[model samples]
Target: MKINYSPSKNAFYEEEHKERYLLSGSWPGDLIEVSRDDFIEYGGNPPEGKTRAPGPDNKPAWLTIPLDFVEQAKAENKRHTDEANNYINEQQWPSKLMLGRLSDDEKLLFNKWLDYLDALKEIDVSGAPDILWPTPPAEPAS
Candidate 1:
């Protein structure tokens, strides 16, 4: 089994089901080969609340997930909630539905978005990279 570095995952794939990277062939990143001992010691995936990154001289090293991650998550969640609120409140979509201007499906979609926005606002990013983000109504959120 060969270990390949995945910067996006911030960790190494000890065997990395080839289909995910080799077949897709779209993940552009480093190709550092890690020894089995290193993999065993540091783990294929970074430890909880931490991430892998290139350290001195570009060698793989484990680093704690930084405080910036919390701030970043807060900003992202705010952006999503703001957008959703704009559609529901600022745009008066619910009023449109009440006035028979919108379809039932659109109202349902907006309702789901309302729940998703509330979930986003309640997220606790104190865990930084360990945070579990809420899913969006129509798609995956950051």
Candidate 2:
């Protein structure tokens, strides 16, 4: 079977170590090899290429990662997201829904986060800002 990197995953294997790079926990797992077809599909770059390998053309252009490592990384990421979502629901949601609206201090904090969320798509997982639910729309004019 061929191993392809999960697009949803934020971690990868460094060609230098020939081991998976975990963005968080360094869990142990069995080593898995990638098939030639899968490697070609991933556009894997050969390690060191001509300078170190048999030659640039002779080597593949991708690195392989352990299958178990991929699963572990995905699970860890999910756990983090779930915890953050729960915190937002419990801590931030009620504050936002209060009848009188947020205090100046709260509003400032929320707006800052709103701005940050607007820029979140471009951020890496490690750099992502706290979860910020959308603010309610302003009331209509009298």
Candidate 3:
């Protein structure tokens, strides 16, 4: 993500100076190249670790995009939409809460998993695996 920082506006301050980021304008070397004009004129003029402040009118500009995350998020959203549509069409809408009453077998299965989900809500699962949850224990053979 790209962020633009400039001096405050329509507010009160103790002092006023040129915007810091406006002059620095250090873009990621991989992404942007400093213009020849900027290099010749503003190059190293500020000196080692020089600093400045922005005036009331100074406002910075920035442009950026999350190239990878955007694609991932888009894919995940499409998947969710497809899943929701499929569920609605095939299973039909259940009760507001986990559907209404179910057959004895269905009720037993739902309760068993519902308890597990509820238990999960009480714990942290940030690093949990995506599948084969509540992993089975290893077996010991003779």
Candidate 4:
């Protein structure tokens, strides 16, 4: 008996006995044991199973804020801004607060609050549509 093999599927078949078997050893390349007449008459085409397409080359775009969460986020941002502003008003800059008299922790806290205020100034409150997600780069030609 002669052995026939399909490297793509990692399988083998015995020619005269007409038996099929999964490959147990390393492939020996594309070897056909049956005569062309026998192969054409009996063997039909080999199965080509489904193959997965390659994944996108670039990373997926970031998720946008859902419509339901937008209002909540705006409210939280407003609350934080108000608290920071209140702290600033009570401290009164140019007084001991800004005169380098405060402790290191106090100075750090003040700087952080100032940074928060600066960031709040940049926030867009116009409730713009959420179509600003980054797009993956186009796939290269095959």
lDDT of 1 at 87: 64
Better of 1 and 3 by TM-score: 1
lDDT per prediction?
0.71, 0.41, 0.35, 0.48
Q: How many clashes in each structure?
A: 0, 5, 6, 0
Order candidates by lDDT, high to low.
1, 4, 2, 3
TM-score of each: 0.49, 0.33, 0.24, 0.32
Error at 3, model 1, angstroms: 2.9
lDDT of 1 at 137: 66
List candidate 2 segments past 4 Å from native. Answer: 1-61, 92-100, 107-142
Deviation in angstroms for 74 in model 4? 7.6
**CA error at residue 82 for candidate 1, angstroms:** 2.5
Name the weakest run of 10 consecutive residues (lDDT summed) in model 2.
Answer: 46-55
Backbone clash total, candidate 4 = 0
Give lDDT tens digits, candidate 2, residues 32-67: 344556455445433321111111333333333445
Q: Which candidate leads the pack in TM-score?
A: 1
Q: For candidate 4, what is the TM-score?
A: 0.32
List of clashing residue pairs for candidate 4: none
Better of 3 and 4 by TM-score: 4
lDDT of 4 by residue, 83-104 (tens): 7777767866436675767777
- In order of TM-score, best first, we have 1, 2, 4, 3
Q: After superposition, how far is residue 115 of candidate 3 from its true place, in Å?
A: 29
Q: For model 3, how does the per-residue alpha-carbon lDDT over 1-142 read when each residue is reduced to its tens digit?
A: 2233324421111112224423566322222223344334332323322222232334322213334444554454455445444543453324523556456654454444445444434432221211123321222243
Q: Which 10 successive residues of model 1 have the least lDDT summed?
A: 133-142
